[model samples]
Target: MLKVLIVDDDKNSREVIKLALERIYEVEVALNGVHALELMKKNSYDVVICDYVMNEVDGIEVLKKMRKSGNNAVFILITAFGSSDTAIKAIQEGAFEYLSKPFKMSKLKQILAEIEKSLSEKKKEEAVETNKDFEDEQIIADSPVFLEVLKQMARIASSDVPVLITGESGVGKEVVAKSIHKYSKRKKGPFVAVNCNAIPPSLLESELFGYEKGAFTGADKSKPGYFEQAQKGTLFLDEIGDLEFDLQVKLLRVLQENCVRRVGGMKDIKLDVRYIFATNVDLEQKVAEGKFRADLYYRLKVAEIRVPPLRERTEDIIPLANYFIKKYNFYNREIRLSQGAERLLLKYRFPGNVRELENIIRASLIKARYTGVIMPGDLGLKEEHIKELNREEILDALKKAGNNRKKAAEILGISRATFYRLLKKFSIE
Candidate 1:
């Protein structure tokens, strides 16, 4: 059963809310903010409803405290004097919904119904997703940010909207596209990948839209193109920002018409394919520069997903490294990462994101030859490794400051929260 915690200074208000919700939710009541916090720490709740005003602690403070403590329960604020400022504050403090006091029990019930239905659907989708191995589209990450990205991917997969994946080169944009296709309803169909820049302009036309048997020099036999081949499937166009201007017009026409024309054929053939475009470059910038078509850019960006680079989300470093280690370890020997090696890998900025991490792990494993533990030397880190090994480093600074994170962050030329975040990323106690 779903649980809800109610916090109100007034005993009568608390009792009324409990009575209204107890029929459906397993309701717990708290007299004030302090009591509410105590109850929150003691038990897990699906939802929390707190009164806006109280003597010891206000609803905003209680909500902030709960959020800072990593409580993800849905919070609803009950306010007597509702205003724009109050509503904004409640939302900013992570309240899922706010109800003005003296509101009907029916209204509250309606909101609860919506929340329950939404949670139920989300759970069902997750259960279906969890059954798939998704090896090729495996996303290795423990960071909250990256996990949210995965969740966004799942939500986007339920639709056939064209998705434009944006990220730096080697940040796994293609992997994200493939994952979307696998999770989507079109999973049973083909997944065709096309590199827009890789194909020559003269041939790209024929490559994307097939020609008649006698249309071109090498067209001895009529063959279907990418769009035709990806019928009822997904067509992933990678680096689409680099597509030529003239070809962009043709592609836009195809998108607008939902059909393709053979290079020499008379009529257009209707298509039923989901389009997923990915690019490392800023297509918006290209559009501004008049290097790309404005209409095509708009069409491609119908639903955009940004794949974050590795350096920003440091928590993914270790897991991605381990994944690659297991991937390339053909002999399945006991090759493991040493503490020093882990430190070095985390310290060095992975400019190449997941791809770079995988490459590093592969090279390191090959250097180690699956004999035993992989050391810092196996990582092939250059000057960055030397800088990380300095005696008067951030780690030493932390020790000197008696593990005072603020002073350690100042010593390391970074923010205090960043220092703490790095500590957690590296699994430093």
Candidate 2:
């Protein structure tokens, strides 16, 4: 059972709350904040229910201290002196909920039930995410070029040097990074992936470096940043090319010092994080253009691995497609690709790379579920690049072939079945 701590100055109030929660959780009572903090240091709590107003140390102070110490237990502050401002302040101080006195006991119980359900769901999601990270290491490398990239990853995994993975946007750079982490000595540790471009440039620094309780406005409690969280683990910084110049300098400093200081923190916390950075953009060109820092680029590029794009490694397309089909075959449908579909896939260049192929497979599998065979039309490659052989081009081919479909197929460099599908798709008579 999850553990809960109830802290109230009044003995009656403390006992009442404890008695109510004891049936659902392993409950503990504290007379005041001092006692609660003492109990906290000794025990791990999943939730903390504390009165807002108390003697010696108040509830807000307790909450702040707990957060500072990195205890992420759900805190709910109850108070008789309730106001909009007080509730807001409590929430800003990191209280999960601020309940006014004289509320229904049933209401509190409902809230607890909701919290429990949400926590369970959160755990499930985390498990799925962790499982995905493990799955990412299971890369499909049928092509000789991709196999060489895997070899480089293995060589890089043996040492602790920083890695810079350069590839196109959907070429599975992060997957390669995860595979490296999985094969490394630090395989047992966590792998934290942060997308530099995804986070806003303004908040990215604080998010990356963390901040103290009074770091800035609304920072009522201390929080550890990504650097601190990734200690004893691998920190994969994706899209490092998009990092701001100022943060780049700070990052360079962190790399050089092997430690990080929170935004308003007085002392530096040493890090044992293995760094892996990835970018689709050319960092050397960015350096030449004065966008990216040369020194930081050099620091991160200690061991460089460039992933070949899908177009460059077309040999892996059908195998990767089949792999994705099997992965998404949750209903265990006997799905297979048509020869025409395989030829279509090989003939077309996948500018979006493996990610696109997976999406295509997922969508195609759904469309072909009943048939057990994914056709060229089911692959949904008709959206963008299908325009390469436009309606006019087909018409021209038909005109040149004297309106014979088979002759037109020959003229257009496609199979007769594909030509018929295109005619039906474009509603050409």
Give the best candidate by TM-score. Answer: 2
Q: What are the candidates' C-alpha RMSDs?
A: 22.5, 20.6
Off by over 4 Å in 1: 1-134, 384-429
- Which residues of candidate 2, in runs, are more than 4 Å off? 1-137, 383-429
Across residues 1-429, which tens digit of lDDT does each residue of candidate 2 receive? 667889999999888887887888889999899999999999988789899899999999999999888777878899999899988888777677889997778888876765564454344332211123334236888889999998999899989999999999999999999999999999999899999888999899999999999899989999999998888889999999998889999999999999999999999999999999999999999999999999999999999999999988878987787778767865333567765567678767777888888888988866555335565656767434432567876898799669989767754547677788889888999
Residue-level lDDT of model 1, residues 281-397, one tens digit each, is: 988889899999888999999899998988878898877777677677653334566554676777877777788888888888754441245655568765342233343465786
lDDT of each: 0.80, 0.82
Model 1 lDDT vs. the true structure?
Answer: 0.80
